[model samples]
Target: MVAAYRFKPVVVVLLLALLLLASLLSLALGPVAIPLDDTLRVLLQRMTAAELPADQVLIIEQIRMPRTLMGLLVGATLALTGAAMQGLFRNPLADPGLIGVSSGAALGAALVIVLGGTLLAQLPTAVLPYVTVMGAFLGGVATTWLVYRLGQSVQGTSVASMLLAGIAIAAISGAVIGLLSYLADDAMLRTLTFWNMGTLGGASYERVAVLALCCALVWWRLPRQASALNALLLGESEARHLGVDVERVKRELVLLTALGVGACVAVAGLIGFVGLVVPHLVRLLLGADHRRVLPASMLLGAGLLLLADVVARLVVSPAELPIGIITAVLGAPFFLALLLRAQRRGGV
Candidate 1:
């Protein structure tokens, strides 16, 4: 038991090291290159003395830091949400955006972007991301509520009905987004399209900091819920017999899922498959115990997103592809492989 317990922290540390390596690589990457040596010196100098040459400091502070932080935060949040969703619904297939939360967030962002400067101009410039973030959060929460209500009968939450409702809501919201797109001008359309594709190019420290804090909160709290979720695997009645509060656990997981998903969608703009991919990947490697699974997913997710972002930067050179595109391209093949393996094993 002790050896088993020790394994998770060991794996977490290894994954964190890998994520750190990828983040350093991200700093080295761009249209104008900063050599690894100077990048390290710049990063170290800023950390040690908070002072450096203007150009070096600017590259490290103004440019690379925010982008790297955003990638980490968004990555961590996506993975955490995936873990929470799986726990809540008791299905490996469960995901945050799988229930229309992502579509709802995207719709909210589309509305803001389509409205032009006039819509959000009154807000202070410093708070624009926060405004958009709030809109996305509310949108996700609203959609989740709708899904729950529509899916619930006297039978409580039915996964099938919830999924069907999500599909229905997503379809309607997507059509609305299309209608808005049709009316968009060239610049607005370009902006909306790019945003939908997802990039962290416009990251700011303030936004990254906010997202980091949110992800941190979820990571800290969610892992503690693992034993309870593990108990849930035995069926609700059995879990309740084991002194687990089934409804309370469900409620908490749902709330935590919303918070984590909201923070990620707010910043990352609906990057799919991380939630689907990471938790399952970790489960395959670490076992289904959420204790090990959650932390492993967080680390793996961060590494995967950083690697994807790196590929996005290099894939087209001077023109960066959206990170979402890279993730989807990479993840679709992996998803298919997993599907086939599950079929062979008779697990699905």
Candidate 2:
């Protein structure tokens, strides 16, 4: 454990390096395959207000830049929330979706897809795209609020109750999504399918700005709870004995997780596994310290998502794969391996 503590800084540095490399690769590699030097030049020119090839500048600034930024923000938010949820629940396998946020967001997108043609037709054409995003964001927030309320009692919020409530909510949301899918026409079904599968294709500066604000809020606030989280790991009674306000910490963590993960699911759709996988990997490398887990999860999560997006882009050339599929393909096997190892070690 002391060795893990000593190595934490080194792990952080390595994750940062990986994030930087992933960012560069995300910018340079795509269907057009811009050179690394050219990508750097374009970024520099954007700040310096200098001239560059209009086409190259247009592609980088208008498309890939926003996508890459969105990936980083979404990845960081998911992983950060996942770590917080695990700490709050005192369960290593807990993820942000354990609160039903992702399923709720999916249900929201499904609603918009199935009904938007008629119900939203009166809205201006330019306003249509945002309807789905807003639907998703609101849906996630609403569901999380419901779950929180269900978990409340005279004593305080119960983490076990919350976990069970989340599971129930997720199941209901899944059924609703299925019903919506059944009601959708072929085109609507296709759109809904893609949205559920996840994509960064809709990324724009506008969407990125909203998600960045959410990410910033979460990042700014969550680390402050690191000590409380560390304490809580010893159990709620012990955390209270140590002078931590367990209830307040739980409230803050839930609220922040909802905001961050809601915004991410709103923008990117149901990209899973980052929340479930990244934090566990960070803990494995750096010990079960929330202080080490949180920031390291953010860095590693951003790098992992960026790399996954890269593979999604290249796997089929001009035709892209859903990034959710890429993450699941990469994450699921690793997760199963973890389960197997835990069982072998009698840790499960």
Candidate 3:
């Protein structure tokens, strides 16, 4: 809104280029370094059912590739959700995680980690593969619905009330998580503690497939609301006058955001900053149009997180820092600086 980014469509292409650059760099620069050309060769060989050096194939096909792919999907999900939320709320400060979705999803995952095999022992084996993901999705959707319902007053929807309700739900979920933590054994506690920071080290083909589905679901649904979001930017009455169906749009946006974020959180633990930062960066680079914002957010977010994952791997050599830490270190200061600038202009 403050300024137009020059040549919008080209910028989206450049973002895709950046994501490709990050992917190649990520595939090459791990603890066990593989040359970029060799990485490409290995990838091609795998695709064509050709043979390669066993060691090179093992590292690329088994380890780094899945992690990189998961990073792309999870990052895209968070950033897309954030962009959608900002569009819905008509504020740059709006992040998907600002609502209770991430916390609710985290709580659901914690429940599975703590009690799944024992307390949920009777659950069908076929359902176990997806139980955790389904739990997270349902939790997030339920929380979003509750917050939206609470925010609706006789006159209209209240952004303040929505934010406040989100805070309340987050607080309650945190308390429940604390209780779960108390009940967990050492093993469960260790697993639960991993949720404190996001990591993609556990990435697998199955997870990559699952997150791809979630990303596909999100990618399919979000851009459809671009026009409605643009209308809502003019305020609820104006959106209604423009035939935007404000309530339905809001419901659809919130649920879709929940679905995407919940699935990513379930798979990736709880990466932050992608949702909070990437969409803002996209808007600053590509303008406020939701159509441009959503897809651009996906590319930039994937690139940023892949870059972060590379740093996470290299920062400590043999030991890796959590991806969340890298993102927090990067994001926290950016957020503070943005806040300071906004205050100077009295936009806060």
Candidate 4:
């Protein structure tokens, strides 16, 4: 019992250390290849006192740092949302994409990319990305709200209904995306394709700041839901009997998850499997207690994504692959395997 109490804080410390290591590695990596010592020096020179050579300064300031920080924030947000979703639904299969949010956000982003050049060009260039991000966030939230509404009824909520609604909404959103693609001109089509594929190439320190703010908000709300999540594990009816306020918990979790997902897909453009796979891995290693699982998910997700992004950069040498491709390559097989296992277990 003493060991059990001590373990959580120890694990949290270790995870934080791992995150710091991943952040340093991400900043150190890329095609130009700053040596680790030089990289550290450049970072220290920029953050503290001392002058650096122009070339090293440019590499650290103008290139890798923003992208690396963005990766850490994006990874943490997606993973936190994933942990929350799994806890809310009481299902290992639950993920951000499972609720139609990703499809909707992708559609919104594609629309903005495909059409914004002509329409939004009239507006200030500085305002365009913000407009696009707002559109995507709203679209994701809208679709998610619709799914929740469709799933709930006079008889009460059903997981099957929720899953079915999500699938239906996802199909509808996909069709919308297809239509948008068809209407797109050659340049717009190319842009949409690149955006859909997902890259951190567009990340800036400003965007990182915005993402961090959103993540901080979500993180603050999430830990308080731990007891609610624990009660949820007993099933909704039992949870209510245990004074869980099941409906309120569900609502809070849904909104928190949606906000986190919106922040993520807005910046990253539908990077897959972090949400789906990270929580499951966390549960497997750390157990299902939300107090532990939520924090663990954040660490594992950040590491997984940071590692994936590193692999993406190095895989093609000078030409970096899209981060999405790396994650899909890792996540799709695991997802399928989980689906098959669920079928065998009578849980699908």
Candidate 5:
């Protein structure tokens, strides 16, 4: 296929190398500024049973490491989810945030946080996390299904309809969130405020482990659909004629995207644009083929977020900014540029 010509081995290698470099730099360039050599030494020290200075070991082991890893997981997950969502919808503009999936997840999470006291008081602390996450996942699935349905009729999926539905869903979701905020007391309101802002400041070993597991599951599942997604781009009827299971593919992509994204949102709140922008960039540079788009988007997405997280930390210095702000600053310009370019080319 002409599309697969750009899938160079070197591109994947370079992306991976960049991701590794960003991860290490993230570990080194924090407020305390752990040296690269010391960072390596401490990481190996823990793995190889060697001794290092107590404070340095603590910094690498406890603080920067978890945060860096969390950034990687969150970035990769959002990108993967984004790529899959775009492919499923056959629109480069599709994204978890743009299509109201994140809003739904946020609504679910907000409900959990605001009502946990009265409604969920009897639930065990251990199950509370899963409850919120499941709520968010269900919300994503529901919104995605609704959007997909609305976007489809006797004809193919209508990008315009999907976009409009997303706007309506976002408006309704925001109204619901505002209602939840109104009902919330000061403490719950504060929690909701932070969740809305979105940060990775709470990263820890335990959370990273869960994020890793969910991300791994998504990575495993998404690539398997690459060929099917390729067939899908030919249109649902054509794909079905070619023996592709259109319904199954849609269901799988929706659920998998929702599951991974919901977990990430449940953990890190709503971080936007990574999904919308990264996949388009991947397709632009590499190819439109889902085989290339999906994996590259994941890697580049991780690298982009890590770079953003780094900027988020360094821009405000010791008083680190929330990552969502950093992404907005970066993504907004790129988005506008994309739109302008598409407009110049007679519009997307």
Candidate 6:
């Protein structure tokens, strides 16, 4: 552990460098395929007001830049929340969806996609695009709140109860989403299917700003709970003995996770696996310390998502695969391997 601690700084630095390279690739790769130098030139010119080719400027500034930024924010938010959730649950396999926010958000987005034509017709055209985003965000928060309430009792918030409630809520939400999918028209069905798979294609400055704010709040606040999270790994009763406010920590972590994951789902649809996989990878290198895990997960998640997006773009050329599909392809095998390894070790 001491040796691992000594290498944590180096690991973080390497992850940061990888993230920087991934960001550059995200900006440069696509159907158009801007050269790395031109991508850098366009980025620098944006800051310094220097001249560049208008088309390159338009592509980088208007399209890829926002997409890249969104990828970073979404990836970091999901992975950070995942790390927090695992710490809260004292389980390595726990993820943000363990709280039901992802399913609730999906249900909400499904409603908007299937029903927006008539139900949202009265809304201004300018505001129509965001109705789904808002709905998903609100739905996620509402479900999390309901789960939190269900977990409450005379004994205070029970982590075991919350976990069960979250599973139940997620099931209910999934059922509702299935119903909506059944009712959707063919056009709506296609849209809903794509959205469910997730995309960064909807990236816009406005949406990125909203997500960035949520990510900022998460990044600022979650790390402050690092000590509490560390205590939590010792078990809640042990955490309380260590003077950690176990219930309050649980409440805050749940709320923060909802906000971060909700915003990502709202904007990018249902990209998965980042929250479940990235933190575990970080822990493999840096130990289980939240201080190292959280930050390292952030860097790695952002980088990995960006690389996945690059693959999504290149694999189909002019058309692109949904990023969620790419992540699922990558994560499922790793997840299975982890489970198998754990079983062999009698840890599962």
User: Among all windows of ten consecutive residues in candidate 4, which has the lowest summed lDDT?
Assistant: 45-54
- C-alpha displacement of 237 in model 2, angstroms? 0.5
TM-score of 6: 0.90
What's the distance in Å from true for residue 151, model 1?
A: 3.0
Q: Quickly count the clashes in candidate 1.
A: 0
Please provide, for model 5 over 3-112, each residue's C-alpha lDDT reduced to its tens digit, 9 standing for 90 to 100.
44555677789889989988988888867787899788776644443555677777777888888888888899899889887787787777888888888888878878
The whole-model lDDT of each prediction reads 0.78, 0.85, 0.83, 0.81, 0.83, 0.86
**Candidate 5 Cα errors over 4 Å, as ranges:** 1-7, 47-51, 119-124
lDDT of 3 by residue, 26-68 (tens): 8888788888888888866544445556787788878988999
Candidate 6 residues 205-253, lDDT tens each? 9889878877898999999999999998888788999999887898799
Give a tens-digit lDDT track for model 2, residues 1-348.
888888877888899999999999999888888889988988775544455567778888899999999999998889999999888877665686767888887777778768766877788756665676678777887888898899888876677788789899999998988888888889888777776788888799988887887788899999899999999989888999999998789878877887788778877888888998999999889999888899999999999999999999999999899999999998788778876886788764
Error of 6 at 35 (Å): 1.0
- Residue 44 CA displacement from its true place in model 5, Å: 2.3
Query: Could you tell me the TM-score of candidate 3?
Result: 0.93
Worst 10 residues of 1 by lDDT: 45-54
TM of each candidate vs. truth: 0.89, 0.89, 0.93, 0.91, 0.93, 0.90
**What digit string (tens of lDDT, one per residue) describes model 4 on residues 11-114?**
67877888878777788788877778877887665444345456766777777888888888889888888888878877888788887887777777777777
Off by over 4 Å in 1: 1-10, 46-54, 115-117, 341-348
- How close to the true structure is residue 318 of candidate 3, measured as C-alpha lDDT? 80
Worst 10 residues of 2 by lDDT: 45-54
The parts of candidate 6 lying over 4 Å away from their true place are: 46-52, 115-119, 125-131, 145-169
- Please say which candidate is ahead in lDDT: 1 or 6: 6
Residue 113 lDDT in model 3? 75
Error of 2 at 70 (Å): 0.5
Error of 1 at 71 (Å): 0.4
State the lDDT at 289 in candidate 4: 84
